[model samples]
Target chain A: MKAKVYVMLKEGVLDPQGAAVQHALGALGFDGVEGVRQGKVIELDLATGTTEATVREMCEKLLANTVIESYRIEM
Target chain B: MKAKVYVMLKEGVLDPQGAAVQHALGALGFDGVEGVRQGKVIELDLATGTTEATVREMCEKLLANTVIESYRIEM
Candidate 1:
């Protein structure tokens, strides 16, 4: 089975990288862009019967820093 | 308007970050994980009437490295 994890910074967290990208866009003449939030996706090809619980555990333990980031899992 | 850009390393491209993460998972005992690919998501809050063409241009120019990465846009 295939699974995907989307990890993003929590609302209100400062994202310097995103801000830098937004600034770069403005410099590049993409003035219509208002804001940008950057995140990551981790795609996994898993063995059969890998439970959602295990994936969630993976996110909690290693994939995401829950204090400042949140993650969603899809299979 | 809102737009999302997902940028991923093209198949056959080497991803050291993904490989490192996969190795870490194995070290932490996630034996069922077969493979992992890491990508990025850029969420954009755009001005009204921002065309998809402009967004694609942004991806082409700044968001993705078309030489080794491909991007998908969602609105």
Candidate 2:
């Protein structure tokens, strides 16, 4: 099975990278972009029987820094 | 309105970062991980009426490097 993890900054966290992208968009004449938040997606090809709990453990251990980011897993 | 863009390296492209992550996971005893691919997600809070075409244009122009990456947009 395949598991996809989306790791994003928590609400209220400042995202400089996202702000930079939004600024560039505005400069390029693509107005109306009011906010931007950048994150990461990690796709894991897991062996059969690898449960969702294991994926969550992976996220907690290595995939995300939970202090400022949150991760969601889709199997 | 909101737009979420997912950008990933095209298949057959070498992803060293992903390989490294896989290696780390294996080192940490995650044995069933067969493959890993890393990507980026950009979430945009758009002004009302900002069309999907505009989001695609942004991906084409700045959010994704079409030569090596492909993007999917959710509006």
Candidate 3:
């Protein structure tokens, strides 16, 4: 099975990396960009019969920092 | 309007970060994880009518390193 996890910063959390990218975009003349939020995608190639519950456990345990980030899983 | 860009390392590219995360998962007892690939997502809050072409230009110019990464845009 294949699973994908999308991890993103929580709302109201400061994202310095996203700010840096926003600044870079401005420098590169993409001023139309109002705001940018940067996150991550983790693609997992799993063994057959891997359960969604296990995948969710992976996110809660290691894939995401729940205090400052949120994660969504797709299988 | 909103746009999302998903940037990922091209196939055959070495991803040390992903490897490190994979190692960590094993340490944390997620042995079912066979392989992991990490990528980035950039979410853009744009002006009311930002063109897809412009967003693509942003990906080409700054959002992704085309030499090693490929990007998909959603609007």
Candidate 4:
């Protein structure tokens, strides 16, 4: 099984890296962009029959910082 | 419109961050992981009618380093 994890900052958290990207895009003259949020994707190649619950535990334990981020998993 | 851009290192690239995460997971007793790869996701909020071409341009010009990374865009 393969698992893909998306870890993104929470709604109220400020993302400086995302802000920098948005600002740079404006400087490049593609001004249609209004907002930007940057996140992480971790792809795991797991043994067959690895359950989604195990992947979720990985996210909670190490993949994501729950205080400032939220994560979703796809298997 | 919204664009979700995923930037990942090419297959041949060495991903030390991913290796570290995999090692950590093993230390934490979840040993089914065979491999791991880390990537970035950038979400863009654009004006309605923004074309996929525009997002591709962003990836080519700034969002991804095409020499070592490949990017996919979802709108």
Candidate 5:
């Protein structure tokens, strides 16, 4: 089985790295690029028959920094 | 316009960070968590009428480390 876990910063959190990317976009002459927020995705190849609940537990336990990020699991 | 860019390490690249996470997961008693590969997503809020081509340029120019990562855009 294959599972993909996407972890992203919660809205209202400051993303300095993302802000820098936004600034760079403007510098490169790309107009209307307002802001950027960055996050992570973790892809796993597991043995067959893994359940979605198990993947969610993985996200909660290790894949995401829940203090400032939210994660969604896709199989 | 809003663009979501997903950036990830190219396969065959060594991801020490991901390996560490996998190790930790096994340590925490999660079986079948075979491998972990990590990546990033950049979400942007732009003025209306931005083109996907323009966003790809943004990605090539600054948002991604193309030497080892690839990016896909979602509008």
Candidate 6:
């Protein structure tokens, strides 16, 4: 089965990369742009018997850094 | 208002970075993992009256490369 995970910076984290993008957007004529937070999406095709718990562990252990990010898993 | 955008590779695109991560996962003892696809999530804090249509256009024009990826918007 396919599992999709969304990983995002926790609230209050400063995203310099995203800020750079936002600045570029303004220079490129997108005046209405406000703020941007950048993150990652990881899609996994898992073994047939893999449990959600295992996937969640994967996110916690390797896929995301809980110190600065949070993750949600979808099957 | 806040808008969340998800940008992901097309179904058949090769994701080398994701493959690298999967390989590392296996080396780190996550044996049941299979395939991985990498993508991006961009969160936007918009002006109060921003329209979803404008956000969608931003995704198409700058946030994602339609040649290889697709995007979704959430309010």
DockQ of the candidate models in sequence: 0.92, 0.95, 0.90, 0.91, 0.85, 0.79
Q: Candidate 4 lDDT, tens digit per residue, A1-75?
A: 789999999998999999999999999999889999999999999999999999999999999999999999999
- Identify the leading candidate in terms of DockQ: 2
Candidate achieving higher TM-score, 1 or 3? 1
Give fnat of each prediction, in order: 0.86, 0.95, 0.93, 0.90, 0.96, 0.88
TM accuracy, model 6? 0.90
DockQ value of candidate 6: 0.79
How many residue pairs collide in each prediction? 0, 0, 0, 0, 0, 0
What's the CA error at residue B19 for candidate 2, in Å? 0.5
Model 6 chain B poorest ten-residue lDDT run: B25-34
lDDT of 6 by residue, A1-75 (tens): 898899989999999989987987777677777799999999898888888898898888899999999999998
Task: State the lDDT at A49 in candidate 1.
Answer: 100
Ten-residue stretch with the least lDDT total in model 4 chain B: B52-61
First chain TM-score in every candidate? Answer: 0.97, 0.98, 0.97, 0.96, 0.91, 0.96
lDDT of 4 at B30: 97
Better of 1 and 5 by lDDT: 1
Residue A3's lDDT within candidate 6 is 89
lDDT (Cα, tens digit) per residue for candidate 6, span B4-72: 998999888888889998998898888877799999999888888888988888887788999999999
Model 1, A28-55: lDDT tens digits are 9999888999999999989999999999
| Local error of candidate 1 at residue B18 (angstroms) | 0.6
What C-alpha lDDT, on a 0 to 100 scale, does residue B38 get in candidate 6? 90
Candidate 4 DockQ category? high
Interface RMSD of each: 0.5, 0.5, 0.8, 0.7, 1.1, 1.1
Two-way DockQ contest, 2 vs 6, winner: 2
Error of 4 at B29 (Å): 1.2
Query: Against the true structure, what is each candidate's TM-score?
Result: 0.99, 0.99, 0.97, 0.97, 0.93, 0.90
Cα error of candidate 2 at position A31, Å: 0.8
Candidate 3 CAPRI classification by DockQ: high
Q: Model 2 chain B, poorest ten-residue lDDT window?
A: B48-57
Write the residue-wise lDDT of candidate 3 on A1-75 in tens digits: 899999999999998988999899899888777889999999998989999999999999989999999999999
